[model samples]
Target: MELSLDAKDTAFRDEVREFFSTGVPDSWRDRVRAGLRLSPDELTGYQQRLAARGWGAPTWPVEYGGTGWTPTQLCVFWSEAARADAPHQFHQGLELIGPIIFSYGSPEQKDYYLPRIIQAQDWWCQGYSEPGAGSDLASLRARADRDGDDYVLNGQKTWTSYAHVASQVFLLARTSHEARRQQGISLILAPMDTPGFRINPIATMDEKYHTNELFMDNARVPVANRVGDEGRGWEYGKVLLDRERMVAAANVIFLGQIVRGITDAARRRKIRGRALADDPGFAAKLAQFTVELTTLQAMVLRLLDDMTRGADSGPRGSMVKLRWSQLYQAGTALWVEALGPEAAQFAALDGATLPADMPAALQGALYARVTSIYGGSSEIQHNIIARRALGL
Candidate 1:
């Protein structure tokens, strides 16, 4: 497909670009560029600002406060925001559960949750992964036994991002064991302050408390908190996961930032009396990454167009997600390699900050390792492509 903006698109793109340049706060932009996690208060403030701008849930239905932009316009918004290093709406509330809720939630649920979500009154986190159920989410052992008006929850969830601070968590818990393992599962919207729910922080090498382990001990969640019907949580989870596959291309936004940082570093550093960027081998490597990145971006555009045309991008999306994460990991690894001795400085600092680019490169490299794992692992993605796409 030939992808180029005509006059109308050009105008829309300019509008989006100007909004990002002036709409996002300078402090927010700098924190994102530096790879720093925003505090809960900062996150709420920024999300509220985006909500006020009517861009909070750009892809949701218009009745739910969506912007109703065309696919190309959505692309322009994301591209402009990425280029500006602007913070985005919380994906959990805006992308993941928000879609599921609006699609399957009760009318009351929609009226209550969607507004709070839009206004940043509630922060949502995914609770799909348990102690043993990261990639194999179907194997989650969290239980919610029925007790009249409530279900008593008991189990642990690991690697739940932002659980410590999020206002709520959307989890999948087993309500029965008689049928299939994936069956009898139900989605629960558990409040963070619910009795018997606790969070234990898990700090990573990135010097960030990026995830947490959640423990639930006889937590009483109302039957009303259950999303859709019980024993159908797996189906709902699939909807969310498919949505995740769609946005997997979003890795490009960060990949672009890393590539720019690498380019800046190379342009400034000298290699044997010449700019590092002038080296023939270094230039060739960058060219290879550029070509691959471009191809990946083209695939993303195709996926978006297919969605707009009401096509099932399914297995094709698995391929895109797999490649996007792998290419990102490759790009970040190459960036660290190019940093060489400069990387060694951050080696001991838990992630160096001086020279600016060094820490960015190192942190990107470390975080890239997880890119292939979350949303879905490279292996699981391969499995989907193999069985569903190729009929192997």
Candidate 2:
């Protein structure tokens, strides 16, 4: 596929660049470029700025405050944002829940949630995975039983990212015992502040508290909070999961980080004043990284093209996920090899405390290890490709 930007796209790209350059706060941009994490307020503030420009939900319909751009334009937006080191603002609300609600939610639900989602009024988190049900989500045991007008939810959700900071969570709960495992599920919206709800922090390998374990004991949510028909959570969840995997695979920021890592490694030496980039073996590794990146980018563009043609990528989404995850992990491993022992000493630096020269690349490499584990894991993705795509 031709990756060149056309004249019109070039103009659009310039406009987007100017807006991001001027509209986003310099402090936040600096922090992002330095490999630091943004505070919740900083992240929300950036989203609000994009929301004001009607660019908050890039993939939604125009009626829902989306830009309504073409797939290519969307790709350009993401690439330019990463190039500028802008903080990611579209994942939780715009990418995940916004689509789910707009696709499956009632008009009242749309009216109630879409505005807050666009305006960044409510931070959202996923409530899908549990301790026993990470990749085997159909085996989830989180139960939600109807009691009059409300569903009493009782179960624990593990690896709920940003749960402590989120105002709401979209959850999948077991609503029936008679139906098959995948058939008895329902999607429910649970407020984080509800009684009997508890969020316990889980310290990650990177020393961050971004993920948590959520406990619910008879937490009550209105029946209206259900996203779609009862006993159809698995079907609806497949839609959300497909979309999630696609977006997660299209994370161009990781590509940028990989590029930066290669560049930094090239500038540094391994033994006795030999630049790592000068070594033929290390140069070959960098070349291999570039090739993998190119392949992943092309695959992503093809998937986006399929989406543009209204063709379901289906299990091909897992192909993208698997390729990107493998490439990302390989690139990071190469970076660690280039850095040698320095990889161990560099702690993951927050956006506020990043140094100008290659801060936290090692930490990022460590975090990338989990990239294959989370979001259905690479093994699970491969199984999906085999079963759904290859007729295995």
Candidate 3:
């Protein structure tokens, strides 16, 4: 598919580019460029800055503080943000649960949560995954049994990113057991400080403190905290998952950034008095990666365009997720390779500033190893594409 931006779109892109260039603090962008994790306060502050400019929630309706930009404009914003190494807008609240609350939540829910989400007043994490149920999420066994005015939740959620830092969590609990799995699931909201909630940090190979194990035992959330009907949480989760799949576009943009960084580093390094970029072997690999990045980018733009035009676009999200995962791993691998053997050295795990691109590339590659696993595994995406996109 041919992708072209009209004049108006071009102007919007320029505006977005200019803002991201100057609006975000350079210190924050530097950390992001170096693949260093930003503190929770820094993240919230970045989103608040976006909020001041009315750009906090790009995909939400204008009524709910969204920019209401078209899909293309949203894509442009994301591209520019990645290029500038802008810290991402808080995704769990802004992208994942915010839209769901506005669309399916009660009026009180909207009043209480939507503004805080856009304002970044609260940190949020997802509570959908469990030790037993991950990609096959319907098998999740977390249960929330009803009491007089609240549901006593009992279960554990693993792989929950930012739970340790979050103030709130949107949880999926099996509210009914007699019905088929995936039919009786309910989406519930609970404060992290609620009774009987515990968080355990999981040390990842990437040396990041992002994921956590959450234990909830008799956690009392008001019945009113349930989003929408009791039995349709699975449907709401699917909506979030579709949006999550499309998020591969942003990762694709980051992969491009990694490749560019590697290319720049290669041009600066010399082998036998010749720049590494001058090596035909390395150049050939770079050329291949360029072609692959271009193909994947075009695929993402086409999917966004399809979505914009309100087309069915069956399984294209899965296709993008699958392709982007593979390409991300490959790109990060190239980054580490370009950086040489020293890139593998372990850096401090204290979220300290990575001094240079070498450590960044190494940590990124380590993290990239899980690109295919999270947000639905490549295996699952392949199955989805086979069944829905290819009619297998």
Candidate 4:
């Protein structure tokens, strides 16, 4: 499919580009470029700026503070943001839990959470994966027992991204064991400060505190905290998961990273007085990767077109996620190879001194290792394609 942006879409893209160039705080941009993590205040400030512009919640309905932009506009907005090195708007709140609350949450829940989320008053984290339940999410053992008006929750959540920085967590808890493994699950919203909640950081190869292990011991949350009916969380979770998968499939952000990787690799001298880009073998590989990247980007735009035209239940989302993850991993591998040993030895440098092109490309390659893992693993995406698209 040939991907072309209309005049209106191009205008919208320019608007978004201008906004990021001028609207996003310089400090945040510098931090992202330098490969340093944003402080909590800096992160919240950036999100609040988006929220102020009514660009905070991209995919939500307008009633819930969504920009109500067309899918193409959303695509452009994401591309511009990534290119400008803007702070990542954590999706756990806006992308994942906010939708769940708006869809299945009670009116009280909506009134209580949605506005704050849009205002950046609260940061949210996902409490889904547990120690043996990463991919087999239905096997999660986090339990919540109803008592009076409260549910006492007890269990652990591993790889909970940004939990330490969040004020609340949207969790999945097993309320019954008699029904199908997936059937008895319930979604709960618990304050991070609730008694018996502990967050321990998980160190990754990048030396960043991006993930955490959350332990909930007798955490008491009100029944009012329950989203949707009990034992139907599995169904609700599927809705949220579908949204997550669709967003993940949008390869715009990763595409920008790949572009940067190629540019950086080309500029740096490799061996024999030649840059990596001058090497025919490297050039061929870059050309091939770009072709695939372009194709995947087109697929992404097509998916957005379908969504803009009000098509739901499209399998292209899964296909995009699957292809993008594979292509990204491959592209990053090529990028690191081009960097030679420097890719491995580059310490996680502070954002201030980082060369513009190299840090993000290098760190992004490292972070892409989890792209296939989180938001549903590559294996799961394949299963979805086979079952939904291939009919195998």
**Per-candidate TM vs. native?**
0.93, 0.90, 0.93, 0.90
In candidate 1, what residue range of length 10 has the lowest lDDT sum? 27-36
Point to the candidate with the largest TM-score. Answer: 3
Off by over 4 Å in 3: 1-3, 25-37, 348-355
lDDT of 4: 0.77
Alpha-carbon RMSD, each predicted model: 2.5, 3.1, 2.5, 3.0
The residue-by-residue lDDT of candidate 3 on 1-392, one tens digit each, is: 12378999889989988897776665564346444467888888888888899888888889887888888888888888878778556678987898899989999999999989989888899999999998889999999999999999999999999998999999999999856787999999999999999999999998878999999988899999999999789898767655764566665655566666678668877788999889999999988988988898888887787778877667877777788777767777776677666665657576655435756677767777787898878898888788877789
- In candidate 3, where is summed lDDT lowest over 10 consecutive residues? 27-36
Candidate 2 lDDT over 186-272, as tens digits, reads: 989978999989999999886656889999999999999999899887787555765764485447433654666566666765566
Residue pairs whose backbone atoms clash in candidate 1 = none
Off by over 4 Å in 2: 23-37, 252-254, 268-271, 347-359
In what order do the candidates fall by lDDT, top score first?
A: 3, 1, 2, 4
Residue 192 Cα positional deviation in candidate 2, in Å, after optimal superposition = 0.5
Where is model 1 more than 4 Å wrong at Cα?
Answer: 1-3, 23-41, 347-353
Scored by lDDT, the top model is 3
TM-score of 1: 0.93
C-alpha lDDT values of all predictions:
0.79, 0.77, 0.81, 0.77
lDDT of candidate model 2 versus the reference: 0.77
Q: What are the per-residue Cα lDDT tens digits for candidate 1 across 1-392?
A: 22488899889888877877775655554345434455778878877877888877777779988888877777777777778777555678888899899889999999989988988999999888987887788888999999999999999999999887789999999999846788999998989999999899998877667899999999999999999998898888677655764476555544555566667677878888998888999999988988888888888888788877887886878888788788877877777767767776764456535765645567767776787888778999898889997899
Residue pairs of candidate 2 with colliding backbone atoms:
36-350, 36-351, 37-351
User: Residue 221 in candidate 4 has what lDDT?
Assistant: 95
